[model samples]
Target: MDKLKKNEKWFWGGVVLIELILFYSSSMTYKQQTSVPFLEKYVHGKPLKSSLSQIHFNYGGKEQSIANDGYYHFVEFFIRKGAHFGTYLILAVFLCLALYTYFKKNHFLNVFVPWLMTTGLAAFDEFHQGLTGGRTPSVTDVILDSAGALTGALIVVIITYFVIRHKNVKKV
Candidate 1:
């Protein structure tokens, strides 16, 4: 309709695209997975874990470290956990943004479209991981992603319902 509205579409479109890129980047496991700079600090100077540190490095290029053990292992475990939780937040954001856009145009499918897109994106991410060096597709991740989308949809619907009701009450 106007420039502002058109720009809004582009803005949200970028958000979706960037999120996809981040999702893929975070899941991939390559040689340098553990050679993270901060991780290297743990090695103390030998370029290897201390005898007490039970670390697992995927590839030995002095980069790309996957934690097989030690504190690094703990970090890796928590990172995965955190990633899943963040995925839920992203799903919610995308669905909310999409519905907001659709509302401006009276698009009845807006709510449904977000869920469809979110799942499709999750499936794509899982599939992409399958092709990566050391990554496998997990049905669990997809389920979590979908669950996040569902939660987002329900939240928006509930919020909107209450807002409309409150407005009517005020008018009366």
Candidate 2:
């Protein structure tokens, strides 16, 4: 392979490594995970929701807390799920790029491989979370993660199709 090809592979490999590091970091205790900038701001004080009407759901049969200091847990829940989506989306992008660089031209491989890889990783991530002291693993999160990966892969497919079409047009 050419130098550029090698460099691209290295770039994708680095992305995967960074993702793994993130996965490991997420395996930390709830306290460790919440010690970050924005979360730290609402870590302590009185419970935010006084009435049951404020909105919250049970995780592992235990009611999730709306934060102290009046931060709505409903908002936090979506933010957390959104983070999962964003991370998997990035993972899918890199995975698709790497596969395109290395594999033969095949529409199925381009989509299926990345989707399978991402879904598997998401499952493993949930399993890891289950092992963590305060984290609860949810199949719903796995579905959300897979959907994100699929969306990312589809975006790449659309862009690649247009790029290839443009190249052919230039050749014509």
Candidate 3:
């Protein structure tokens, strides 16, 4: 096989691996997925807690400020949301890379297809979460995941644009 085919296979493999991770995590109950214990064990200190105590905001119909939920819960909230964002971002990036060659004739399809696939996956993930104990599916999470996917697809599009532009300039 050619180098491009090998790279495409690797990219698709990455997408599969990420999807498996999402599935495994979604299968676990909230109790099983909590990072609080790990944080409490390894990050011993009041400095972070005290400094962030004043920060507060509402999320998922509840107040998530450090003052309302304590430092650990507050921190955990961001960690979980960040994970959602980062995971979808990587998923979309991999999908884009994997689909790029196939959809190269249409730039719009190259970006749109990956974003749509990532969004569909995010929706499915949330639906899976609804079946898990102590876990509630949220539309808000799906939105966040979609946003992350869009960002990742845009990043690939931007990079490709620059690379192609540079090559054209070099040719001239």
Candidate 4:
């Protein structure tokens, strides 16, 4: 009935939506999940070719070289990793908000529980990926996801601290 209760419901809804998205994506094959065709149609250009060509690294036990693998694969690699980071970051934020609303008195649990849940979900996601065709699990991805979760949780913590401090100051 109150504003806090409504906000808590919204935050939990966001978490559920994110989980559904992850589940659907995990169910797809690697080829089905690739955004290469879309990128080639709209994003392919000389500037991308030049910039992406400069990037070379080893990922998933393979060399991601533009010259060897082509520009599309090279660009897709970053896009995929960014998606992983961004999705987990949002999930963490929602988790933090929902937990904070429910457990306002337990500040330690509010942060720790979200990080643990995000990390656990990341690991589970990787395991699910292994089940899909043409997809393999990566521990590195789990670490990256966890890092994103940490960043989001810290952002929430910092903002909450400042907002609460400001309110307390105003009351004096």
TM-scores, all candidates, are: 0.59, 0.75, 0.92, 0.90
Best candidate, lDDT: 3
* Candidate 4 clashes between residue pairs 3 or more apart in a chain or in different chains: none
Candidate 1 Cα RMSD after full superposition onto the native fold (Å): 8.0
RMSD of 4: 2.1
Tens-digit lDDT string for candidate 4 (1-172): 1355569979999999999999899889988999889888888453568777787888667888889788877778889999999999999999998888765666677688999999999999999989998988999899999999988888887778788779889999
lDDT of 3 by residue, 1-172 (tens): 1344569989999999999999999999989999988877777884577668767777667887877877777788889999999999999999988988887667788789999999999999999999998999988899999999999989987887777789789999
Ranking under TM-score, best-scoring first?
3, 4, 2, 1
Q: How would you order the candidates by lDDT, starting with the best? A: 3, 4, 2, 1
lDDT of 2 by residue, 1-172 (tens): 2443566766588567857775886688776765345654765643444563476666545565554223545445657778888888888887877777655367678888898999998998888888999887888888888999998888877788788789789999
lDDT score for residue 89 of model 4: 94
lDDT of 1 by residue, 1-44 (tens): 24434566664785577577756675768554544456557645
TM-score for candidate 4: 0.90
Per-residue lDDT, model 4, residue 123, is 98
Best model number under TM-score = 3
lDDT of 1 at 82: 60
Query: Which pairs of residues have clashing backbones in candidate 3?
Result: 56-65
